[model samples]
Each structure stands twice: as C-alpha cells, then as structure tokens.
Target chain A: MKKKDVLLKALKCAFPYTLPILAGFWFLGFAYGYLMNVSGFSFVYPLVMSICIFGGSLEFVAVSMLLSAFAPLQTVIMALMIQARHLFYGISMLDKYRGMGWKKFYLVYAMCDESFSINFTADIPQDVDRGWFYFFVSLLDQSYWVSGALLGALFGDLVHFNTKGLDFIMTAMFVTIFAEQWMKEKRHFSELAGFASGVIALVVFGPQRFMIPAMAGILALLYIFRRLVEKMWETGEDTE
Target chain B: MKMTLWQQAATIALCSLSTMATRFLPFIIFRDGERTPAFIRYLGRVLPGAVFALLIVYCLKDVSFFRYSYGLPEAAGIAATLILHKWKRQMLLSIAGGTAVYMILVQFVI
Candidate 1:
C-alpha cells in the first residue's frame, strides 16, 4: 500500500459512520472526566485511562472501585466479566484478522465493538491498506474517548450542562446497527427470531438476565430451525 | 488531599487495567486463530439485539412507569425517539433530535 492510499483510507474511515462513535467517545470521556475531577482525582486520571483503559463501562466502574477501595484482583475480574463479550467478538473475527504484522497486537488490543462493527461490513478494499485503516479507526476512536475525558476533567467546573438525554446514543446506535442488519437480511426468520427472542427475554427477565439468555436463545433457535433459517437465508441472498 | 501527577497517572492506569482485562484475550489480531466457531457466530448473531435491548433499559432504568424522569415532556421525548427510530431509520437524528426535544420540555414545559 502506497503512503498516499493509506492516508486516503484513514480519512475515509474517519468520517460518515465513525461520527456516531466519535460522539460516544466525547460524552463518555466527558462524563468520566467529570467524575474523576469531582472524585478528587487529577487530569491524569482521565488521560491515562483514555489512552490505556479504553474499555467503556469498566472505566466508569473503575472510578468508583478506586474511591471504594476495591482489590486489584477484584477489579481485574470485574473488568474481564464486563467486557467478556469481546471474547465472542474474537471468535467471529478470526478470518478477518488473520494476517497483519506488528499492528496485529494493537489491532487486537483495540478490538472494541465499534471497530469490530465497522470492520464487520465494508469490503476491506484490496487496493487500500488494512494497517492504515485499523490505525485510523483505533486512533480516532481512542482520540474521541481520551480527548473527551481530558477536556471534561480540565473544564468541568465551568460547565453545568445536563446529561439527561445523552445516554440514548448507545440505544440509538444499537437500533441503527440492528436496523441495518435487518435491512441487509430483510425479514429473515433467523434474524427476526433472534430479535423477537431478545425482546421477549428483555420483557420477561427484565434487563439483568436478558442479554445472555437472549443471545443463547437466538443461537439455539437457529440451530433448531436450521433448515428454515437456511431457506430464508438463501432467499435473502438471492434477492440481494 | 490533592493527587499528584504520578499518583493520578498510576490510579487511572489501574482503572485502565480493567479495560484491557476485558479486551485482553491473548490472541493476536490477524493471526493464529481459526475460523470463528459456530457458537461464537451464534453469540454474534443474537448478542447485538440482546445487548442493545439491555442498554435501552439501562439508560432508562431510572425512568419509572408510575412516574417520569424530567416529567411528561421527557417521557414523550423517549417515546418519540423509539417511534422515530422505528419509523425512520435515522438513529443519530432521532436520538439527538429526541434529546433536544426532551431538553426543551424540561426547560420550558416543566
């Protein structure tokens, strides 16, 4: 990949779809920053966390864990469990990730859902360089997060803004992703079934148990109805 | 007591440690791992919706059915969001727009 092309791909990855992620990075960083400042930590709290511990939820939890004096081992366990979903991502991404160089470690390290989601689709143009693409994606996403945190920590005193509505971005992002997937598959049973099962589980189990059960249910449902799912899937592909 | 630069750095470093822990599966990117197993593919298939659904609740966990967050307007904003998201596939617009509407309601109507 020529230097020129790499720059181009990095720019391409920066705009459009990445905007939502950037927004998230901003708010999450800002909130983390506010919390750190109020909780009696310095700017370094948010900065180092953003740069190194880019894990979304865990970072928030980490703040309280420190204030409350949690054991390091406990924090480690909690972090692993909270982000355990990434394990699933690793399994699915094996094929796509199989051949990079030194960048491989960082790429894997930076494998958050946002990056994975973006990468899951879009033809990784043979002409474009993967490393540059990954670098931009990782760098931009991290920047959004870190910068947001840093900014929030520095100027939190002056700001009295309400965050009442900001959290919806996560929900909105997911809806967008799900809708896109639905559009791609177009009313396929497996997709619909999974979605339906997930909703039902949400209502029944409430929020706490819904995710794991619903995910497991979807897989089982697909396996049970493999023939029908395949038929629908084939039909979907044919239409495409 | 005010935290020093190094202490802040180290403390946040501890915090960031958890993030890495979650993201910390040892396998290198683009190497060594075989095709995603069927189970993982299954996890991927359902995980998005399931997780999203949970996030919706988590975000609104404080909003009570018997009561409202910032009152009726904020409540309406949420419903408007769900409707707009479902009706029009405009997520960013719906969320931002819905939030703005909620903010307005809280500011003026409430």
Candidate 2:
C-alpha cells in the first residue's frame, strides 16, 4: 500500500517486541546514567553516550575510562575488546540485513544485543515491511535507553526504590531468548557449544577477560563441527 | 575529570568510532551485492542460538559462586525465568516474574 502505511504497520508490529527491552534498558540505562551522574558528569554525557555508543556494557565501562587518566591507546583497545561481540552480531545479520537501503547504516550502528536478538528471531508478518520492522525495533529500543539515561541523570537521587536485583532482568531476557532458540532448533550442538565454551572460558580466563576467549572458543568449535552443523541444516533441522 | 574537555570529547568520540568499527566491519568485508561466502552464510544461520547462549553466560559471569550469596539469587532468578517462560511462553511474563523473584530474594531474603 502507501509508504506511510508501510512504516506505520511495521511500527505497530515492532513495538510489542521491544516492551521487554523497555524495562531492561530503562533499568540498566538508568543505572548507567545514575552512575555517570554520581561520578560527577553532566546529564549531557549520558544522553550523548547512550545515543552515540548504544552498547550497554561498553557505555558502562566507558564511565570508568572517562574517570581515569586519559590514555587514548588504552581507550581504543578497551572499546574494541568490549565491543568485539558486535562483530559476531554483524556477521550473523549480514544476509538478513541486506537491501535495506539507507536503513542499513543505522541498523548496523544500533546492532546491540537486544535489538539484534529481536530482529534476528522475530517472525515478522509477510505483509509488513521487513526493513521498516527492523528499523523501528532498533529505533524504539534505543529510545528507551536514551530516555532512561536522561531520567536517571536528571533525577537519580530524588526517587529511591529497591532496584537492587533489577539487573537480573537482562540475564533473564537472554535466558528466555536462548530457551526459545533451543525449542526452535532440532539440534543442540551450537547451543551446547556456546554454553560449554562460555563456561570453560570463564573458568579459565576469569570474568574480566573471558569474553574474547569465549568468542574464540565458540568460533573454533563451530568451525571444527561445520560439517555436521551444515549437514544438520541441510537436513532441514533448523526451523527458521 | 583530569582530562580537558577537548580530551574528553576525543575519548568519547574514539569510543563511539571504535565500537561502530566492530559492528560495521563484517558487513563491510562481505558486501551485500557481491556473493557472500558459503561458510559465512552458514554462520549467519547458526550463530544466533550460540550467541544467545554466550550472552546469557556473559550476563551471569560476575556472580561469585563461592562467596557471600553464593549465586543462589542468580540461580533462583534463572530458574524462575526458564520455568515461567516454558510454562506460559509469554516473554514479558517470564522476564517480569523472574526479575520480581530475584528482586525479592536479593532485597529481602538473601
């Protein structure tokens, strides 16, 4: 139908998927903004950082980087290490993200964990425009984050509620997503590899330095088992 | 804030730039119109399941199983989420229920 109708329909379809993210990002982003505030930065810092960076973990880590003495090299290296996971996200989304025209740029830029999960997994209706669906998902998710940051930065100490364990929302979100993926796939090799490699890497490398190693392990395991994995897909085991 | 405003701006700019670099690199390397390698395409299909798993583990990596709370709170939260999800199959319900359970446990019980 009309171009306006296409975007509206996609926006309607996309909003529901972002509701969970609304909660998670608000909680997490509020905390990030609050931290930046108490750490002596202005509200502008969180607003800009949330809009520009958009990576939760890195944004949090950047607070400390900002606090410390200026080390440009260290800053670049840290950003790369914290964000290397996005490379995997990019690789996974390459095909699905094709032919989006200009939206492809913003899609790649806003490819955070939450946005990627929804865009990659959600079964958008055929009538809805896929590109617009993806765009609205990313846009809505980022808006939640930016607003939350602004809220916390502006009024962090004024309201005091027990949000001690609220961060668990993210872990819970990922677990549910993983479970959903598990139910969808016929074979568990990739999931098992991901889990085992992550745990082993964590145990071996420790929490502070395990991400890259965990990623490497996952890639290696997947590579080694490519024949079987491809055969499984070839046999029509993947539901997607 | 020991760094000057200019330095701070540069730092944030560098961070945003580098983060974008990682996010955009793969797509840049494997352009859209050109034929993507078979192996990369295969990865695009299978990586989601594994990446989600990795994300879960990454979120919980900081929990100290051997220390004070002993990760009971985290374990309980995850169990609640999985059970609630499997039972109802509603994303919001599972996430909120698990988060509520964890909040109560941490704020009061634990």
- Per-residue lDDT of A87 in model 1: 60
Off by over 4 Å in 2: A236-240
Candidate lDDT scores, in order, read 0.64, 0.91
State TM-scores per candidate: 0.76, 0.97
RMSD of 2: 1.4
lDDT tens per residue, model 1, A99-190: 76677677667877677666655446676666667667777777788889999899877778676556556545555565565566644565
Predicted structure 1, TM vs. truth = 0.76
**Model 1 Cα lDDT, one tens digit per residue, B32-57:** 65565565555445444434433444
Q: Output the chain A TM-score of model 2.
A: 0.96
Worst 10 residues of 1 chain A by lDDT: A186-195
Per-residue accuracy of model 2 over A1-240 as CA lDDT, tens digit each: 999999899999999999889988998888889999999999999999999999999899999989889899999998998898898899999989999899999999999999999998898999999999999999999999999999999999887877798888888888888888998888888998899999999999998888899999989989999999888876764445
TM-score of chain B of each: 0.70, 0.96
